[model samples]
Target: MTMHLALSALLAIVLAWAGLLNLAAPAFVRAEFEKWGYPPALRVLVGLMELCAAVLLLWPNGQRLGALIGGLVLLGVVASLLRTREWLRLEYPLVLLAAVALVALV
Candidate 1:
């Protein structure tokens, strides 16, 4: 249980940070989004979804739902990276997806 909580906290923190970056519309994020053929507005939407997932993960009763959402989000990211042929970028989301799945199982 302790390990599970620790992993959950870690994932939540990472996602929250990423979400903030997306919401802030940093230059790097904007460039990356453009490279991925996504509109600037999509960054805010993704950020909001990530933030909600982080919140759900932090809430004791919402862990499962959070894990599910987080996993789905990462899955989408993986798909996008694959579609764009960004092989190098797929690693992070794949790892996160695994973590999210583990958290969901726990």
Candidate 2:
């Protein structure tokens, strides 16, 4: 249980940080989205979902829902990376997927 809580906190922090970045939509993020052929507004939408997932993850009764949401978000990321042929960038999301799975199970 302690380990589960610790991992949950860590994952929530990472998700929150990423959510903020997506919401901020800095130049690099904008450029990346543009390169991927995504509309500028998509970043804000993704950020909002991420923030929602992070909040759920932190709620004792919401972890399962959080994991489900987080998994979907990460899967979208993985699919995007695959679509863009950004092979090298796949590792991060894959790792996050594993973490999400662990959090869900443990």
The candidate that wins on TM-score is 2
Instruction: Give a tens-digit lDDT track for model 2, residues 35-98.
Output: 8889978888889888888998999898878888888889999999999999999999999999
State the weakest 10-residue window (summed lDDT) of model 2.
64-73
Off by over 4 Å in 1: none
Q: Per-residue error at 82 for model 2, in Å? A: 0.8
Pairs of residues clashing in candidate 2: none
lDDT of 2 at 73: 87
Q: How does residue 86 of candidate 1 score in lDDT?
A: 88
Error of 2 at 14 (Å): 0.6
Per-residue lDDT tens digits of candidate 1, residues 6-95? Answer: 999999998899889999997998998898889978889899888988999998899899889888778878988999898998888999
